[model samples]
Target: MSGIKIIVITFLLCLFIINSICKNDICINKSNGFYADYTSLNCQTFYFCFNETLNKTLQCLNSSEPIFSTYRQRCIGVNPLYDECYLVNINENHENCAWFSVQLSTTSNLTYHYSCLYPFLFDLESKGCKHYSQVQCNQRFEPKDACDYHHPQIHSSIDERPCWLIPSCRNKTNGFHGNQLQECSSYYECKDERFLNLTTCPKNMHFSDKSKTCLITLSNCENSTKF
Candidate 1:
């Protein structure tokens, strides 16, 4: 019985090895005859083919998976000969595609095979080259005699009027004064009589009479004594 158990274990192990070999062979066969050329731009290289099946497969591979097979199903059964493939060359410096690729592999049903020749889709902007129109706009912003005056100065102060009076006192009125007052002056009396009655006068002004008149001493009043 022990010898029989050993034989059974060996048979299962052999079957597992055969299954693995067949799977690898299938992958190898699928990779054969598929070729892509990567064109680099802005330090990134990309490949594009109009074949729908290949395109769909690549799109699925690019996305996060667990849904990879479901995504792959969108294009896998289509004829490979008629399908196009797009491979975006990842920019090492940019890291956007690299991170995306890692996530895609982790989450998807597709595995990266080093033997496969993945192509790149060329994008001029990604290659560090600017379009002609963009170059023109960049030139317009450069220093030029025609635009020197038109370009606003970097540092400018608003033409602010001097604050001649405190903001709160601008509309307030001066209060009446009795005789023995040294001089007549303008004072800030709040429109609300209660505020005038309750609030103390500011340092530069003084309350003259009980009626809410505040006084600013002025030397030019005609009746200086009645101020």
Candidate 2:
């Protein structure tokens, strides 16, 4: 065969090999949009093709997973801390409400946290992120395993109450019961009608009033304790 004929045959063979591999391993097609529902079997590699041409090869970073966004026409990382949640309008129609779970370190302990995309809240009961109106907002303390804020400021007197972040304490009426003291947890209570008081956790530790326990930090209270 002539040199030109041999070159043409080689080119055709290369094209056939590439087409076969793409057809078997990827979901991209001629009619595919900017992005396609294509992920590697390893779940850590993905690709973005433009105009039927492989444009980019992206690898998942850290603990993030690689995903393709049909709306964005690209590859993205589903990072817990930096992931964006899609927002639903006030009407609460059928929409995607994606959320990410993040691990955060407080002064005392390591805690797992979840953030819903805009206008959504993480539902503990459902174990899923849902629309704000759909979720039944907990008006009470979280379970003992969760991390919650502890107020550390010193009050002027026993009559003066500090403010914590739990919902039950916020709803309690000041001086409703005798001495107006409702123990939310061993380390915290509702006092002075509208105020919350921390009994054990110091300024440096996070308090879990539900378990009546205090999370200790290296800076101040070096050990977790119960009052």
Candidate 3:
């Protein structure tokens, strides 16, 4: 084979490999809401663009009213958890008395169930209430100048209170800071967005997506698979 022809073939092979590796689907540009997957019409999910990371997890906020919005990539009109009653609690006897059942399961002897009160999401892993998105908060209650008992203190326009009331450590310098939160001996870093130590959890412990804390329990970290 001629040297020039060999070079051309090698370049084409490299291009093909690059295309296969970097599959930046155009659907990534869609807004941070529920969108119907073109490949699977019946499956509607949400997407979140955190900086350059495209989190394509199918988080169906409202499973009951699973209606796609007419406007754009939005899913349902609003998150149903925040509509009426808020505060889901299971008694010691494994009795749930919440308006909606966020999670329900049963073991050999004990039954486990988690419920979400208004504006709070029932985190199945943590078995507690986690703060919902700002858009979800706005659905039922308007932004208030003064913080209320149920609502978290509004530090800034972009601040949405995370679960477990862990402070958003984005204020620190644009680098890594170890063990910022004294409660959990986990590392913290500041970038485009700031949260908790997500890179690694303590020995025999795992990070919780609902609370954003290092939990000794393994089941709590199921949803936080990336970390």
Candidates in order have lDDT scores of 0.28, 0.37, 0.38
Backbone clashes under 3 angstroms, per model? 18, 6, 3
- Largest TM-score belongs to which candidate? 3
lDDT of 3 by residue, 1-227 (tens): 69999999999999998864543452333333233433333334444443334555464557664544312234554444321112233331122211123221222223223233333333334333334342223223321111221322222222344444433443344444334343234445444334433355668764454565677864553221111
Ranking by lDDT: 3, 2, 1
- What's the TM-score of every candidate structure? 0.18, 0.21, 0.27
Model 1 over residues 10-83: C-alpha lDDT tens digits? 99999999965643443221211222221221112122223211221123232222121211222232332222
Tens digit of per-residue lDDT, candidate 2, span 17-119: 9976875444333222233333344334555555456666665555544554432333566644432222221221122222233323321223233333323
Greater-TM-score candidate between 2 and 3: 3
Candidate 1: C-alpha lDDT: 0.28
Which structure is stronger by lDDT: 1 or 2? 2
Model 2 is weakest, by summed lDDT over 10 consecutive residues, at: 143-152
